[model samples]
Target: MPPTDGPYDGPPAGDRVLALDLGTSSARALVLSADDASPVPGALARHKIAPTYGTGGSATIDLHAYVEGLLGCLDELQHNGHLDGITAIVLSSQWHSIVALDNDGGALTPLITWADTRSVEPRLDPAFDEHAFHARTGAWLHRLYWPRRIPWLLSEVSAVSFAGLPDLVIERLTGDRVTSVSIASGTGSLDLATGEYDAEALAIAGVKPDRLPAIVPSGWTGVLAASYARRWPGLVGVPVHPPTGDGAASNVGSGGYDESTAAVTVGTSAAVRVVHPIDQAPELPWELWRYRVDDQRAVTGMAFSAAGNLHAWLTNVLQLDEAHQEPTDVEIGSSRVIAIPFQAGTRPPETVPGGSGVYFGLSFDDDAADLLAASLQGASLEIDRGLRMLDTLFGRELEVVLGGGGIDASAWWRRCLTATFARPTDVCAEAEVGARGAAAVALGLAPVPGGEHLKPAAPEVERIELLRPRYTILRDLAVQAAQELTRYTSG
Candidate 1:
């Protein structure tokens, strides 16, 4: 479609829009010059997100700490010259995190991170069924996201109000208690049919309709209030907009927004969201989310949560030997230990959640490096499975554009991903697609679609090792085990 908004570097206002990317790891800002909607001259600011990883039980983020981190980044921009011409900000974050607030807009509970998958399915008074809920909202009835946590809070805590991470923060920043359709669409509560809150979802989540913010399309133009200006001295009545989902922005950053194009994202989790014709909502083996890119288009996404957890577990936690170095694939290949790699709960209790690295080929000679390499290999294989599911569900070959943490480090894993996928993968120049995607929303720019715009990303510079599809038989055996494991563990 046509450009929704102009590149707004004002003579009175300056020509750049300040796009803030609120992410799980960090809060970053990109000042896009209005003259051409390009990155302006100066320090693009960022602050590392405060870590709130809970080991005792309920994993979450410190809402206060996160907000402070966000401010810290904005302060950095203000301290530098970047905030002068900046007008608007667009936000993006990991899906399914829950943060409850009281009527006064103060956070009431710890922001439940996306990784919080405790046996915490609080009951819905309306008694919604998983399949029925999934069909209506196009969300898997799993414990990983908002559908479970909202009900848990309403039943457990009196007078507790809640929304996903993006909504709560955006409300605080803009003084407008509103959410974007693109942001809300990823949650299980939205009615994909109408792009509004579903009556059934409200009933199930025990949320009052008025408590939730109004949902607007991404890239909408609205002014910032003076109170916010006082809170954030840099807020000068500039227009605020929606960058939408982190994955959606990555599509734009990598140019995966077209009807036929799709992005295969391997972030903390993995997913493939293809923007397709809304008139046809085809059946999908993984998931089908309604995206608000334009007015009519919907993006169906298939997600896998355990993409990088395997590598994290092995490299960081499961330390190999005295050298303290991560292991290589060849070292891992000589060993015979097979890990299932389902540390995180899957989308559903079906063939999802392919858990613990099954020791099918373990040997007495297995070393730490060997085991570590095997773990990475297992993760790559599962990612490949997710890709195959996307192809099967979409009934089209997706030109996979890879981004996020999973595809970045572990040179062995990157090449292994290529080989296991049995397809040529395009790694982005910068791996922070979530931030870049959100920034582009404020810039009114599209990711040069079909991976065509990515600058000559030199081959093997990032060290891509393509693993041919030799382990297809082994993965087939693992799927049966995965299905069985899901049934046993889904309680």
Candidate 2:
């Protein structure tokens, strides 16, 4: 048994459930107390997501390292006595990942994470229409999706099949080779309307349907594998729910079950998503993506390649102590600079190569603090554009429920969002929305659990109003930069 917090008497152990969140750079496990609907104190454990980076934007995770990170969390849970009381284990993992598996289910290659860009030049079939492809799969034609990577992998590696990270982890845990519908939806191979492998997509990618795992509902539950059972006796027969995409879990975890509220997530990347029941597929803009959370609800959103990654870069350039911390009381829109915030290139609207960052209106008088504020403001402006576009699609302006590693920690980040959109913003208390959402799905919570909501401050309103003209200028500059980059890449 693990050490206790103290001489504490709370609800019995049976009311808790274990939630595991596998992300891009780390994995976290926590025991959620069903009695109070909160994570048990001192039960949260995290391990770094150390991926091996190579040249040409190649980042891969060794299968051993990935499994060890998970095992490390389980060890901490066992040490802290979190497993004994847990009734079930639920999982949420990063989307858009593919792992090649051999004939015997052994990993043939390091997991080709979502960040890898080596498949940019795949041999695409001329019969395949990219727009129609996007319409059917609800994912754009990009290197991140399977359409580009699968064909490239077939040419380079001798692999029999592939699976996403969530399904791979589930196989390791439960000896099952199945994927949740939510996870499959992000693979760029599943047809959104049919919820099955798309024949045309498979034809284009030169992949067979059998190469993918069986698809099941996100709430499907199974038992732990015998191997893991022997290793961890406490979890021998604990029910394990099928794993879903972390983004879908975050929507549920942040209380975005209906159309009235949207989920705003800003971690390494940023996105603005809204969840609604499937009602004949709303006419979405060309840039937006449509993914199913389960069988009934569809999550439509726009994603950005830049967010906290941009913040990290600016911090290193500015030499700040904290990457996300706001500098001392600077007025918004007061700086004479505007940053493009596309140091990593634009993800939505289109993927542009060589789209370098642009700092417009920079003057000699401006210091690092002013530049940093301007960059943050530029990102917020892009977010504002997405929000407005989503509103047009939904035919109504929706309130936002903000949650993610980035927004959960920084008040300044939250303030920027609230002021930019001129709407009420609430900070979701659950920093690990993905994990909390997994637990909620296992426990059958209708709305999941959302954290605190922080309202906009009065002082930021004036500053936000002053940014309207600057926002127009920023948008124009971004368009021009993207256009120039497109021409250069084409040339």
| lDDT tens per residue, model 1, 1-491 | 12234434432334566766667666677666543334565657777765565554467778877777777777777777567756566666666677777777677788877666553555555655766667667676566546666766665555456677777666666666667776776667777667788887776566767877677654455566566576556666666675467777766665566655567677666777776655666754434444444335567766666666566666667654535545653532334566555566455534344233464567777776777766666666666565666677677776667666666655566665565555666666555566566656555556542322223223422322332233555656666776776678755
Q: Where's the lowest-lDDT run of ten residues in candidate 2?
A: 1-10
Evaluated against the true structure, the overall lDDT of model 1 is: 0.62
Q: How accurate is candidate 2 locally (lDDT)?
A: 0.77
Highest lDDT against the true fold, candidate: 2
lDDT of 2 by residue, 391-419 (tens): 88888889888888878766777777888
User: Model 2 Cα displacement at 377 (Å)?
Assistant: 1.4
Best by TM-score: 2
Task: Quote each prediction's TM-score.
Answer: 0.81, 0.91
User: What TM-score would candidate 1 get against the native?
Assistant: 0.81
Candidate 1: Cα lDDT at 52: 61
- Assess each prediction's global lDDT (C-alpha) against the native: 0.62, 0.77
